[model samples]
Target: MNTETNILNILGEQIKLGERKEVNFDVANLHTASAINVPIIIERSKKPGPTVLFTAGIHGDEVNGVEIVRQLIAKGINKPKSGTVICMPIINIFGFINLKREFPDGRDLNRVFPGSKNGSLASRVAHKLITEIVPHADYIIDFHTGSSGRFNAPQLRIVKHNQQLRGLAKVFGAPFVLYSKNLNKSFRTVCNKLGKPLLLFEGGKSFHIDNIVTNTGVNGAKRILFYLGMLSSKFKVSTPKKDCVFIEESKWIRAKLSGMFKASVKINAKVEKGDLLGNITDPYGKMNYFVKADYSGYIINVNESPVVYQGDALFHITKKLIR
Candidate 1:
């Protein structure tokens, strides 16, 4: 992976060693006929090393992930010490403009990986990204967040039994490491098929930017670069507050009935069997149903919406842990 080529050809532009360039990843025009050009910020060091790609905003509403990548660029963190660093702070500009998750045509961009050039609008963009940008990255870190109202604790999601990813995730030092299967046609799956090592980060929630989540993401990126000998000396990497908990299996706790929901337990908290997690109550205070833990485990996600209907997910708890 570390061939250390002097020139990198990406998106029809050649970036030489030690050169900094911002390339436009043009896909399609907006409804107003304005050209949509997603900026790809590339920074190369005079010394050669592995190329790292930091991407966010695959789902436009995941602002926390975008903020993390933005801070990397704004603080010159993308300026590597050795190798190259590419930052695509926002991928879905259409959905970003509308403050939505999917593309303007209502297609989930993540579901159309290794896309066809002559397919739908989202597919074209995905195809361009896979063909033009992704091939150049030696390591990829795609940031994301929980969908809907569920807030995910800062975590790195990797497939089970990948020793390489396990080591990398440990070095990244997030609060949690979740072993999950890759979704079909997901970016991670396509990258894996192409033999690129990618780390999928999940934290916070859509449309919300929490400072802690942002810092965790940024710090994790720095740690990864440092481990790869790409991070500049100016940045100081901090050790995680706690050892990352490796969750092997997890389950969602759902609401039994419709009501005003309030969580008494915080996210990432450990709970015992039958512990009071929260309560679901009728608006008129006629009926208050106490929500308790069915099994003891760490709460990885908590639904924050005030109102919830029957069968709405209330919490994500770990079912099993890996020692």
Candidate 2:
């Protein structure tokens, strides 16, 4: 193809063969009376191959994903062995600026996919992603973390019966691979409808960067690129020390009473049925309520915040099986 016919991104920036370009998606903001431009980094290889997309910061407070993309760029994603690598480090700029999970309109960006151009702010952003970005990707990796007050072990979540996507999830090499039903109107569901293979990574806690989780995400991305032939096989990336645990069922352990919570176990800890996971106590230490596991499972997530209300989720447990 001629240089004049090179791929042009949403901002009308030309991404020629073997070239790396940073494009901006400018969305006019009426509420702020300003224009908000979201940054996107695109790297194209001279050789033809699959187009992979990496998106993070959908919840704004999910900083580990953003850092992973940033580190990948710093390590030179501009040069690839084959295909294109598109990185949208921060998708929810409004939420990111405010250090929150949802948009200023109180809408969760992840819950509104394939949105309309003339819809609400969250919808518009989602529309831009589905139209401008999703169409270009053969595979996608969406990065995330436990929402505020929670910590998740580095893991990958996928649909229960997608064997193809499940294989890729294993190759990404997180400690755990969770199979669950997709939430309605989520990015994953939209992409699945479009026949795109996408995987979601959950790790660390919102607003805080955990080194272990961040490193796992960075290495996992590199491993994925290597598997896709976009990176050389000789590329050195850390592999999971143990085989990824596949969990088909997971449940959240909620607080039974309102009080201060003290967790006895951390993420990735193994516990038997009725094991003590944590405890809730009054401010004066007069009353104590022990929280125990309902079944034997691995602790995938733990609430880090001390304060808790009745029915607040404090632990996310995935069923464990005996080999």
Compare the candidates by TM-score and give the number of the best one: 1
Clashes of 1: 0
Model 1, 97-117: lDDT tens digits are 899999988999999998899
| TM-score for each predicted model, relative to the true structure | 0.99, 0.93
RMSD in angstroms, candidate 2?
Answer: 2.7
Q: Where in model 1 is the C-alpha error above 4 Å? A: none
Instruction: Name the lDDT value of residue 254 in candidate 2.
Output: 94
lDDT score for candidate 2 against the true structure: 0.86
The per-residue C-alpha lDDT of model 1 at residue 262 equals 97
List lDDT for all candidates, in order: 0.93, 0.86
After TM-score superposition, what is the CA distance of residue 236 in candidate 1 from its true location, in Å? 0.8
**Candidate 1: RMSD to truth:** 0.8
RMSD of each: 0.8, 2.7
Q: Counting only residues 3 or more apart in sequence or on different chains, how many pairs clash (N, Cα, C under 3 Å) in candidate 2? A: 0
